[model samples]
Target: MKTYTYRHPEAIEHTGEVPVMDEQGQVILYSQRVYENYLKRTFDKMFDFRYFLKYEVLDSQREMLFTVKKISRRGKLWFEAVEVASKKKYIISYENWRIGLPTLFITDRKLKIQLEKEFEDWSNFLLDEVEIAKWKAEFSEELGEFHMTLQIHENSPIQQPEFFVGICQATLFVGA
Candidate 1:
């Protein structure tokens, strides 16, 4: 049994379970554990999570670089990342976010598949704070598709109001 109490003037609060899928329609990593801590074993302190973009389906075939963004909080405050691929090697360009602030574009590899590491930050780097369980990288040319999942804490200190508390169970598919 579940009850939903809506909160107004702030973030939307609901008690319904929805598939936490990414832009590519994949479930957010560790989201299962985030809800019940049953099927998957994550941290006990984890609460809620969401997948923002999940949009990685081979932007292009040729060697190219895209300035990426953090699509999901994944139990962290801020995050940003990009998947780089070329004829040679593949790379994942990423950024750990501070907040939901306006992020700038990375312009070094404007239009090339950087063989080596190709990411640089300005001044304040805080990657150590974000504790990620998995950051997958896809390099299979035969697949022609890439998949990514992000998990963020729904009841962290940075979260406002913090409505992701109480008894929770992850949403599941039902057949009729």
Candidate 2:
């Protein structure tokens, strides 16, 4: 398995670049939260509300790999991630009414990826009833730092792991 870590400085407003590092602490990717409208972004930040935002994951060369956009349906929230090269779309939704740990479902045309929270800060990504990856998050309020780590199995079937990382970042940013 390969491990990747994402680290960023914690902030009240979630808008910045988060760097993803490999096991050797080499920067592998960067996830960036971008807001187009300054007024709207400021307003949302001031009110602690975020409805529309875009997140982009880029390679070390600064080439876009995938883009995630927050979308609303009725009163619930959803996220859509599109692979820039293939235009493949992944839809992620939250199960808000669950009794225990929050769950998220990431679906595409061919696969349905389920992230089942096993503990307060750990989750397992399952594909076809098999554990493909593990996710763990750590937060340090005192130091104002946040970290997300992913352990991906060598045999994992997911083609675009960056998309999953981007979705995870989006979930954290939106506090979902």
TM-scores of all candidate predictions against the true structure? 0.19, 0.88
Alpha carbon lDDT at 81, candidate 2: 89
- Specify the highest-lDDT model's number: 2
Please provide, for model 1 over 1-176, each residue's C-alpha lDDT reduced to its tens digit, 9 standing for 90 to 100.
Answer: 11112111111112222233444544321111122323322331242323221112121221223222223345442223333432222222333333332222222233221111111221111123332111222223455422322233332221211111110111010000
Which stretches of model 1 miss by more than 4 angstroms?
Answer: 1-134, 154-176
Error of 2 at 117 (Å): 3.7
Alpha carbon lDDT at 128, candidate 2: 82
Evaluated with TM-score, which candidate comes out highest?
2
- Global Cα RMSD, each model: 19.2, 2.1
Determine which window of 10 residues in candidate 1 has minimal summed lDDT. 167-176
Q: Kindly give the stretch of ten consecutive residues in candidate 2 with the minimal lDDT sum.
A: 94-103
lDDT of 2 by residue, 15-123 (tens): 6667888889988898888777888787767766466667889998879999998887777778898989999889988786236565778898788888876435678
Whole-structure CA lDDT of model 1: 0.23
